[model samples]
Target: MSCCSTSLAAARSFGSVCSPPLTSSLTQMSSMLDTAAEQMMVHKDFQAALDTCDRGLESLANMEQEDSRCGEVKAGFCILGIQALAELNQWHGVLSWVLQQYEHQEKIPAKIMQMCILLYSKVGEPAVMQEAARVWLHCPSNSRVTGFRTVAELYLLHVLVPLGHRDEALELIVGEVGGSAFTEDQRQAALDVVEEKEQQKQEPPLNPSPNSETTAHTSSTQGAVVRKLEAMLRFFYRKLLLTGSGSFSLRKVFTAAVLLYMLFLRLDPAHPSSFMWISKLLQLLKQMWSAMFAPYHQALTHSKGL
Candidate 1:
C-alpha cells in the first residue's frame, strides 16, 4: 500500500539507516526516516523497516522536545513500525511495543490508538486493546484530538461490545468521557443498543426441538414432523459424538429403538399414568439435547445444502 509522502520519503538513500546521528538536522532526520519507509514499502522487508524505525525513533527521542518536525518524524517511524509488526503477524507484541515507546498507555498518540484499535479488531482480538484504549480515552489531553471520537466509537463497538463489557460501555455512553465523544442522540442510541444486547443475553436460547412451542404451533403437520425428525436425528448424532463413548456402537442404536418403542408404540396420551411418564421422559431428553453438533453433520449439511 502507498503511504503518505511526508511519512515515507523518497528511496534515494534507502540503505539501512540505523542510528543516523545524534546531531541529525531536520533534513538528515527526514532522510533517515525515508530509509525505514523504503524498507517497508519498496523492499517489502518488514523486519528491516522495523529496525530502521527503531533507530529513527531513538534519534528523534531527544529532538522531539525541541522540534515539531521531530515529533512528526517519530510518529511516521512508529506507524511504519506498527505496519511492519502486523505484516510479520506479531500481533501479540503490538501493544507492548507501543507502550514501550510512550511509557504509558494514556500517553500514546490518539492516531496511533485508532490504528491499534482497528488492527486488533481486524485480527479478531479486540479485547487486547480494551484497557489501553480505555486509559487513553480517559486522558483529558487526548479527549480533544480530532480522532478522539473515532477512537471512542471504535473502542465501544470493536472492543467493549465484542468483549461484553456492558457496564463500562454503558458508562462510556452517558458519562463525562462520552460527553465529549458522542452527542445526546448518539448516546441514547448507544444506550438502546447496549440494553438490547443485554436483553438478548438474558433470554434463553431458542430450542430447535420438536416439542418446542414453535414446533407445536406450526400449522403444517408434514413440515412440523419433518423438522421434528431432523431435530431428533441431529440431537442423537450430536449426543453420540459429545459423549465420546462406544463410538456409534449398535448397542446405542438398539437402546434408541427401545426408547422409540416406548414413546410411539407403548405410551398413550389418553392414559394419565402413561402421559405423566412420557412428559417426564420428553422433558428430561430435551434437557439433555444441546445445540452442539458433530463436525460430520456440519460438513454433510454444507456439502449437500441440507
Candidate 2:
C-alpha cells in the first residue's frame, strides 16, 4: 500500500479508540478519557492527549448537573491530564491547571491531591504542595473520603518532613486531621518516624560518602601519570641524544607508539580535568617527534638538493 494510505489507516484505527460512538452508558461517559489515555500510552502523544482531556472536561462542565458520575468522569480526565502534563515536562503548570478545574484548593479530590503531592515531592519542591494539601486536609467535607488517610500519610512523609515543618507535623498528628485520619497506634508510629527524621537531620554524618574522596584519588592518580610521563620523556630524549643517525634504531618508533597509546586510549576515564593531561602529553610528544626524526628530515632535504 502507499504510505499515505497506510498513515490514513493508522489514523482511522486511533479514531476508533479515541472517538467511540456516544452512548448513555457509564462506560461511554469516559470514552473521551479513554481516548486521551490511548494517546498518552499507545501513541506517546502527550500534548494531543492533554488537549483531549481539556475537551472532555469542557464537555463535563457544560452538563446540567454535577452528579457522582460526572464527578468520576471529571476526576478521570483531571488525573489523565496531570499525567499528560507531567509527561510533557510541564510540571510547574500542574497546580495552576488543577486550581482552574476545581476553583478552590480544598475542593480538589483526595486522589488528585495525592497525585499533586507526589509530583511536587518527586521534583524536590514538596513545599509547593504544602499549603494546598494543608487546606485540603483541613476541609471538613474531605475528612471522610476513602483516600483521606493516604493523602495524610503523603502530606506527612513527602511534604511535612521534607520541608522541616516538625511543629506543624506534630500538630497535625495530635490535632484534628491526624486524629480523624489515623488510628491511635498509627499516630504513634507516625510520631516515631517524624522524630527519627528530625534526629537524623540534627546529627552529623559519621562518615562521608565515597564520592567525597574522588578529588584526592584523582589528584594522586594524575600526579603518578605526570611523573611517569616526565620519566619517559627524559629517558627517550637522552637515548636520542646518545645515538647519532648511524646508530639509530626502532626505539624511537616504539616510544612514539607508547606515547600515542597513552595520549589516545584509556587516558580520561571520566576525570573532569583529563584534557590537561592530553594538552601536556601532546606538547611532550611533539618535542620527542622533532628530536627523534630531525636527522631523517635533514638527510632527505640534503639528498634532494644533491
Root-mean-square deviation (CA) per prediction: 15.2, 11.5
Off by over 4 Å in 2: 1-29, 208-306
Model 1 scores a TM of 0.60
Candidate 2's TM-score: 0.65
Candidate 2 lDDT, 180-294, residue by residue in tens: 9999999999999889989989997898676868978978887897778777766666666677534346565646766696776577647766677666667776776787689
Global lDDT scores for all candidate models: 0.72, 0.78
Per residue, candidate 1 scores C-alpha lDDT tens digits across 18-133 of 34443446567677777777777778888998898888777667563564445556666777778888888887798898888879998787777887888899889998898899
Tell me how far the alpha carbon of residue 285 in candidate 1 is from the true structure, in angstroms, after superposition: 38
TM-score each candidate.
0.60, 0.65
- For model 2, the local distance difference test gives 0.78
Candidate 1: which pairs clash? none
Which numbered prediction scores highest in TM-score against the true structure? Answer: 2
